[model samples]
Target: MSAEKIQIFDTTLRDGEQVPGCKLNKKQKLEIAAKLDDLGVDVIEAGFPISSPGDFDAVNAISKLVKNATVCGLTRANKKDIEAAARALEYAVKPRIHTGIGTSDSHIIHKFNSNKEAIIERAVEAVAYAKSFVDDVEFYAEDAGRTDNAYLAKVCEEVIKAGATVLNIPDTTGYCLPYEYGNKIKYLKDNVPGIENVIISCHNHNDLGLATANAVAGAINGARQIECTINGIGERAGNTALEEIVMVFKQHKELNLYTDIDTRMLTELSQFTSETMGMIVQPNKAIVGSNAFAHSSGIHQDGVIKNRETYEIIDPAEVGVNESSIILTARSGRSALAYRLKNIGFEVTKNELDVLYEQFLEVADAKKEVVKEDLERLMYQFNQTVETKFA
Candidate 1:
């Protein structure tokens, strides 16, 4: 792989399922996992195998089914969790055991009730234990977004020495700004011993709605792997959106970075995950939303009608969504009005359209959008008005 290539680690089956009321059975998870592998994600965090029997089965089954992507299972910093993750991934062709512990003072003081030294010891032991089961071991410093950089680097260096091939620096609370997150990654690169030997993975949350930006910032700084989920769905606000990160890298090649993702599969993956998970994607959501390519304003519609690139940066077809939509609303321009009229089988002269445009706006303002039937009725009424004026 090129050094500039960013690895996409999709955690939809794990973190995404954590959303309240959004649960997928084993079969559904396997189906989505298959699609994710086909979509070209570098790693698929199947689930936290030690959390539930259902999750263990899902990870085990996905491990056997997916042919391309490396199957990963999450575990806490403990013997039982790491052992369960290893057993769950026994059938995987390429298996990764992701294990980690809280490193921030808040988590250390409150969540774990431990000190920095104890956290580092647990982190190193966990990585070593996980590495015993699989060649690829990913160590996540949970809440690294708020952890002291020097201490965080200490834990990372120890884990790397203990055989972690990937170091996951997660914005567990979604607290870091982009520059802060970028600086954190850079600090590790400059401070951590033997850091260049392992992949620096960025796992950011969206509490502040900057997960994607922070992830990009980490990539620009030093991180080579991005951990995200489809539709940005997860606990609380969400995680960095997989579609957003992939599309950003695809659109901005000037950064000299790329992912192995098949950009066309983004929309399909988003729809399947949404349907299976029972979460409705917001219409204005980025990348795969219903309104991502829909234009309703007159100026936007006119620009899109004349040249799609005028209004759209990424082609709708590129993501498997339908073509751009020219919706007629109260704000529509004469060009859009005339275009719609022609499509509905009426070829009106500019003068005739000028008379119809005023009536169209009145009807459009009354409704959210004017339908074809409404437009036909308005055209007939305009013709009658013209006849009366002449008679």
Candidate 2:
């Protein structure tokens, strides 16, 4: 538990697949887990073994196949689920069994129709049962955001005493904001005994799109491990994105926390997940999106042509994206057109430039925006002129 390292626990094969239409077969689950390992996540949460036969076989296969990352299986607060998860993780060199129960009053009263004491007891028993089969045990507090902090502290302490090595606090409903989530972690850090000895992990959802922010805020308040997925794909609005968290750490080096993720694999892996899950990555989504590095405005394009830093912050190559784009559109200027044409290895004489410019404007008028291929075709229509460097 070095302060310099931030452990990444990827649940793409489990929580990510929990979405109804996104349910993956055994082979698909294992394939995703393998890719997650290749991306260098510290823990691979394979699946909830007892949830389904398909999940059981997938977890067992991943536990046997994935070598570097710790293989983990999820369980509820019951002995049957705990034992089933343990059976699934038995083949891994380093296996972790994660088990937990609801600690919040709303969940206990409405969801489970139980009392606080009974919920705490169930969590401790589950963690103890999981510990019987594996050295690594993680206990989670479902919907801890609305749970009374003091009661949550009591449950966490009891589970840790029962041999839980990692205590995961999930914002199950994605209801808490960053400021509140950070304070919650700080509260646990101050209240739970021997908390410093055991790793504290954060599992925030993105129901309100604050999962990544809340997770980073948790780290700032002393949580050491983060649970996430590549493209933020999960139930509801999705979970915190693995790529977003890694890039945030890279950009803010002052935090001094490091992850094992190879940033260069972010895009390829995101594309794979999007394609496999039958989901499309939004064109304007933060890091791995198609428009993440694309600029179209005249002023922005001018600065980008002069110096990339004028309009860009992170280099696209660092995140596995190829390059920034100067998209031509109906509103594009001659300077941007000239810049883009030269980038495609085309030169235009004064007369040819006028003709190409008119043609580009006509094409741009037809479409909302002119992309690289459109510009290439338009340039090809004109006589290739070998001219002096214009930039």
- lDDT of every model, 2 decimals: 0.93, 0.89
Candidate 2 local lDDT, 113-207, one digit each (tens) = 99988998888888888888999999999999888899999999999899999999999999999999999999999999989889999999999
Give all candidate RMSDs, comma-separated.
2.0, 3.4
Worst 10 residues of 1 by lDDT: 1-10
RMSD from true fold, candidate 2: 3.4
**Cα shift from native, residue 69, model 2 (Å):** 0.3
Clashes of each: 0, 0
- What's the lDDT for candidate 1? 0.93
Candidate that would win on TM-score = 1
Candidate 1 — which residues are off by over 4 angstroms? 1-3, 379-391
lDDT of 1 at 168: 97
lDDT of 1 at 269: 83
